[model samples]
Target: MNIINRAASILLLLVFFLAFFQNSVHGRPLLLSMSRPKPDDAALFARWLVSQSSWGVLNTIASDMGGAPFGNVVSFSDGLPDKGHGIPYFYLTTLDPTARNALKDQRSSFTISEYAIGTCGKKDPENPSCAKITLVGKLKVVTEDPKETTFAQTALFTKHPEMEGWPKSHDFQIYKLEIEEIFMINWFGGPKPLTVDQYLQAKMDSHTVIA
Candidate 1:
């Protein structure tokens, strides 16, 4: 009878261990799951992309009168937030073709890439240290909205004081970008993305999970 009792106890212990192992393998811990960003990391990347002025590229898709799309590059200033959306705001003159095109058609996309100072040393194409972040979103041109125009103007002045004459030099207009999606590339040969949310939150929350 004692032997049978011992056997039953061992069977229950085995089942408990198997269940524990399965849960451990498949279940994400509450803390670990919460650490990941809730949604796309656009807000975080936008913040960093705005930090370095010359490190980013603004990609715009515009169309001619025939509706054929063309691309152009324009310097931009980061703008004030519209609640949660990462709306990158900037100013441009109506004389500028890109700005003119944007005024005509507010639907556009902008890409911001990480800039690397080219080195003379042997280059490694596969494993570069730099990371690139591109944000695809809609653009709007505003000429009459005083609040938005003022915000864009202030941001431009703060970033480029030399451009203080922008308001006076031409038919200055403000453009606001409403971010829809973001893409990021980390060329450091890691399986997981070098998450922008992780990067931004790291500045505030030093605790990070190590894989």
Candidate 2:
């Protein structure tokens, strides 16, 4: 073959090999990959924890709370949707004692976990897959204001439709949690858990990037 033709042929082969290698490393077909969990799952789990039980061990500061951290099951509802983000919102009744204490302190953490058993029906505390996610975030009490209350209630009802008929007799107070961090472990075992920023950014970029 002519020199120019030979060089062109080699260049094409190099390009082809490079493309193949890249795809092999990172490309995954939709059918073969795991789909992301829907936002609803997080929302549902958060609401379920609150509605079914007001009891959750609260993680709090020691010196602030009489020099030893405290864990207590407190009744709570989902707060407000995160600013510019649609997240599970929760509300704490103003009349609740725990809510009052949290309001006074203004710093706390809350956790919600699912129940699962090992193959032998034994409770495995070390199971990563069964490990519950505990959200550590800054908390603030939402005092009564008709507009804020309306917005929060609307979001809560939308997420938890079953609570629609519940009597409005309770004086619902709003509490907004700014999620600073989240801890989750993979019980199935794989890579490390993703940071909230990393997870959200990946979702955003994946949707925007061209194939």
Please tell me which predicted candidate would have the highest TM-score against the true structure.
Answer: 1
Q: Per-residue lDDT tens digits of candidate 1, residues 98-165?
A: 67776677666665543432211354523433445565666777567787777777766665566777
What lDDT score belongs to each candidate, Candidate 1 first? 0.52, 0.48
Q: Compose the digit string of candidate 2's lDDT tens values, residues 120-201.
A: 1354656555445566766665556777666666766654454566556876555655567765543455324445564333
Worst 10 residues of 1 by lDDT: 28-37
Error of 1 at 63 (Å): 2.9
- For candidate 1, report its TM-score: 0.55
Query: Candidate 1, which segments miss by more than 4 Å at Cα?
Result: 1-46, 54-56, 65-68, 79-86, 116-129, 143-146, 167-169, 188-211
| Poorly placed runs, candidate 2 (over 4 Å) | 1-58, 61-67, 74-86, 116-126, 143-151, 159-170, 188-193, 199-211
TM-score of decoy 2? 0.49
> Each candidate: RMSD to true structure?
17.7, 15.5
- Lowest summed lDDT across 10 adjacent residues in model 2 is found at 28-37
